[model samples]
Target: MATLRKRNGRWQVQVRRQGFPIQSRSFRSKADANEWARLIERQQDRQELGPDRKALKSITLAHLVARYRDEIVPQKRGSAVETILLNRFLRYPICQKTLNDLTTADFAAYRDQRLKEPKHRSDKPVTPKSLKRELSPLSHMFRHAVVEWEIPLRNPLDGLKLRVVDNKRERRLLVGELDRLLESTKKGRNKLVAPIILFALETAMRRGEILTIQFRHVDFGRLSLVIPESKSGYSRVIPLTRRAVAILEALRLEDAKPTDLAFPITPIALRLQWDRLTARAGIDGLNFHDLRHEAISRLFELGLTVPEVASISGHRTLAQLMRYSHANQETVRTKLQGPETGESSHH
Candidate 1:
């Protein structure tokens, strides 16, 4: 049974069933109210009214995100970043909508808003790459809610296509650039910056991995470092070059504890020092992570197979390794100009 009444210049429709809880909604027009009541009655008759509908009516996207941040994000590798992104998502107007009320259009609107928003400390709008990162946690949260939390709703993010513009970097270190950068680091306040930059180039390790390295993880006898955990969530042994070994040996403190970090600086301090050092050196458009790209390219130039380079770089896929390996034009030209071999040379 259903009842339609006018309240405060609005049409209110209420549906009642023998076994289900009462359903009610307010609409601007009588026809809209009647339609909603009819739909609820039909759904009830078909026994399609599930607990998910009731639960969704009471739960907001903000609540879901908060639960996800508390229970799920902490276990992720990039939890810190995920937390920040999730917080931003919670502040959006879409978060006010209940899970059952959320639609694909809402997410599409959110995506458009994110694209139009300028990046912090920059005039440029947020890149698609950044939007993708922000969306990843939200998508996962929806999955967690539907599958794990038993929230009865389809993921609104599903089928919503993101127009991601590829901005994969191919920046490689130029000749004499590393030397000048290193010299500039020596003039800075932090003495560790030069060695950290050199180590990144030598070992091809990420900034986090480099900072997380401890004395106990290094095996000088084998000339390798055992990374217990990396961004890939797997442990890998990286072979140390002579220069890398020398740098580590020189920095090793006689009275240092086994658990003490080889590079004790925080990531923020490292970035600050790097900025100062680069500015002093007059280096532009170069990033510390670019050193990893430079190192990977050097590994390829040294005649190492793709799999072999992947082992050192901790890249799981060949495609990923290829993205980091940007061979310089000079190197490519040298290879092209090398002596011809086999039957072609005999002619």
Candidate 2:
């Protein structure tokens, strides 16, 4: 409906309709006001140039998330992680609201509230890194809705700069820390943790990639393993070190099929086991991902080139690969001595 009123000596026209955002404009004359209102209403009636509130009102954010989780997420390499994130998103208060009622403020509020709370019962508040992952699915879902599903609503997450991305972790294993962590893992019921941790440091493979390994992918003859599906959405063949090959050999079962997953634990169980092992080891400020950083740093220290490290780690960009290549002072000191001639070690 269009209402015309004379305010401040100019005719003001306001268009109000259900399932449409309220729009107002001022015109010099009532004739012009009527014409503009007619055009806007007609255009809106034909469903042009605005979000479709009717469709949005009927579809809740939760519904959209469910659809995206079911239809789109399954095709991705990180489907399990994304599916978990989407389900966690569905429990948010804003998900109960229809897309018509959701504004950018809703998402902003969620970020603030979510950041204040500790996720998964940890004492520390949610880090920007984890929050980025939580919001990633929503960002992609909104884009898919707009482009593929023909949903007329603009993404609320767009322009909301809640995430400070890529907070690089420089945590590396301290002197004798690897041995201590392995000893602690030996006490745990998950017997594979020690070897898995060893394999992780040796190969620089992500936890997901490590967990999904099949027997057929490991070539005992070549001393290499193929990560058929890496986190980068591509298959990469990383040459296993002698230690990594030995770990695989110890874990390989005679009766196991080629299709069996090397590590039968779910990601959640692995996380829980890691937490326990870390606590038992008296380690602080360590994460499972840090092993990859340690591995990549070791690879660089071993005189491997950037391209060589990227091939093993499956990092698509140099920036990302460089993030994990933090070299320590000890490494630099060792390198400056010219191939362990014992010149710098005399101190």
Candidate 3:
């Protein structure tokens, strides 16, 4: 079950547990070597080592990230976001490290290094909000590591505090910005992005959901689209507004097959086009996700209740939904005026 042998003038633990290659470093003391072999053998006897560290220590973070990207993230609506973060943030730094070598200090160092990087090869500093978003997936991965893989003792993220992200809610178009953006979308080389932008603003759906939508998922009669796998693994049916329906109707591909994707663009391509659109629109520091915020704010301005907004946005909690409904100081004063004057029933 366990064997200790002399190698390079030191005793090494060598054990083959149920076809696994269990080999460890050569220890200077024979007693230390024997104890490690015995403990591992006992864990093997209990069927714990075989399922836990047998392959986990050998598995590199790159390997696990690839598996996670293909097997897990594909099933969620946030796949595109996760993919971007993995590629730009986690993948390069940790890919070479084994799972066992991922210490909290290493993660902290990554966070610090990311924060210090000039944004997008420019001299601009990386924001705390962006850094927080990058760290979000790692927390989930470590959770999966502990619960699913049975990695023993301590989550790397247990006590670490991430900076609070201060998000500026994008409410609506400012003056002629929307018209300019629409014109740019139509005349620009990336024409396919127009319908996607329209759909995102109308439905309040994420970019990933828009990219992966299939014709079969649309229910024309019910005026709703079903997302079978969302970020939360909870399937949801989102009711389409008239504008959304119109956009979809115009987007219907000529000679389209039933199985065809609504938009035939990859996530990376869509983002590239979005970058062009934003650059043309003269918008700065706004992401594709800000469009969702714009839509939710529009919903609130249209006098939709919180539940009504949440139904379309897929916000699981009230707190999540509230983050999108930011009213300007002028609007807040106007909204408070009627109540202060005792002239309105609605508060």
Candidate 4:
């Protein structure tokens, strides 16, 4: 049953049932209030009043993001970085709207606004790759809300097209550049920078993987390192080259504990030292990650098959492995020209 009354020049409706909680709302006219009350009463009488429906009626996207950040983000591989990204998403206006009321158009509008917004630190327009990363958490949050939280609404991000372009990086190390970089690193504040760069080039290991290596995880006899934790959530063993082995051997301490970090440097410190080293070397546009690319390409040049390279690089698919395999143009040209056979043939 619903009771209708006039309160301060507005119509108020309150519906109460034997088993359902009292639901109330205010409307400008009595007819509107009656209509809303009838809808609620009808839903309740049909046994359709669920906790999910109640949550959908009251919870906002901001609340959902908060819940996801607390409950889900911590369990992820890069939780610290993800937490920061999620914090930025919480400040957007789209998060303020009720989840039930969110539509695909709202997400499309947010995507456009994000593409137009300049980065806070760089003051440059955010790239499509970055915007795609930012959208990942929101998309996952909506999926979680639907599957786990039992929210009765379609994900607004579903089937929404992103307007930004994705440009894949093809940067490779040039001849003589490596030597200059290594020489400059020897003069930098961090003496370990040179060896770290060399290790990355030799092993094709990521910065995080190299930094996180412990003494216990390394097998000097087998010349491989066991990555106990990785971004893919699977442990992999990376074979070490002679140069990589020599670098680790020189850094190994006789009295070092099993849990001691091999590199003994943080990612921030490595990045800072790298910047200084690159500037001193007069190198431009070469990121540390490019070393991995250079290494993978070198493996391919050495006649290693895709599966062989994938095993070493820990790449799950050949398609992903191909992204890192950038053969030098000169090398490709030489291969295309073929070996010089002095015998002249007349056709």
TM-score of each: 0.75, 0.78, 0.68, 0.74
Question: Ten consecutive residues with minimal summed lDDT in candidate 4?
Answer: 45-54
True-structure Cα RMSD, model 1: 9.4
Best by TM-score: 2
Question: Tens digits of per-residue lDDT for model 2 on 177-287?
Answer: 898899998799988898889889999989988988988999989988887776656887888889888888788789989888887888878999999998999999899
Ordering by lDDT: 2, 1, 4, 3
Q: Model 4, range 1-347, lDDT digits (tens) per residue?
A: 89999999999999876435678999999999999999997786454774344556588889989999999999977677788899988888988988667789988888889889897544679777888888898888877766676454676787889766656677888889999998887787777888889889898888889999988998988998899877777889888887888998899888989999889987767877887788799998798988988888888888788888888888898789867555744677898988888875665
Cα shift from native, residue 139, model 4 (Å): 1.0
Instruction: Report, for every candidate in turn, its global Cα lDDT versus the true structure.
Output: 0.84, 0.85, 0.74, 0.82
Tell me the spans in candidate 3 whose CA falls farther than 4 Å from its real position: 1-102, 135-161, 166-171, 328-347
Q: Give the TM-score of candidate 4.
A: 0.74
Q: Better model by lDDT, 2 or 4?
A: 2
Clashing pairs in 3: none
Candidate 3, 1-347: lDDT as tens digits: 57778978998777765324455657999999888888776765544643444455787777766766667777765677788777765446656777667677777777677778898635887877877777777677766655565444245666666676675565466677667778889767766788888888899898778877888898877889988777666878999988888877777878877678888898888877877887878876667887888888888878788898888888889988767556444566787765575466677
lDDT of 2 at 250: 82
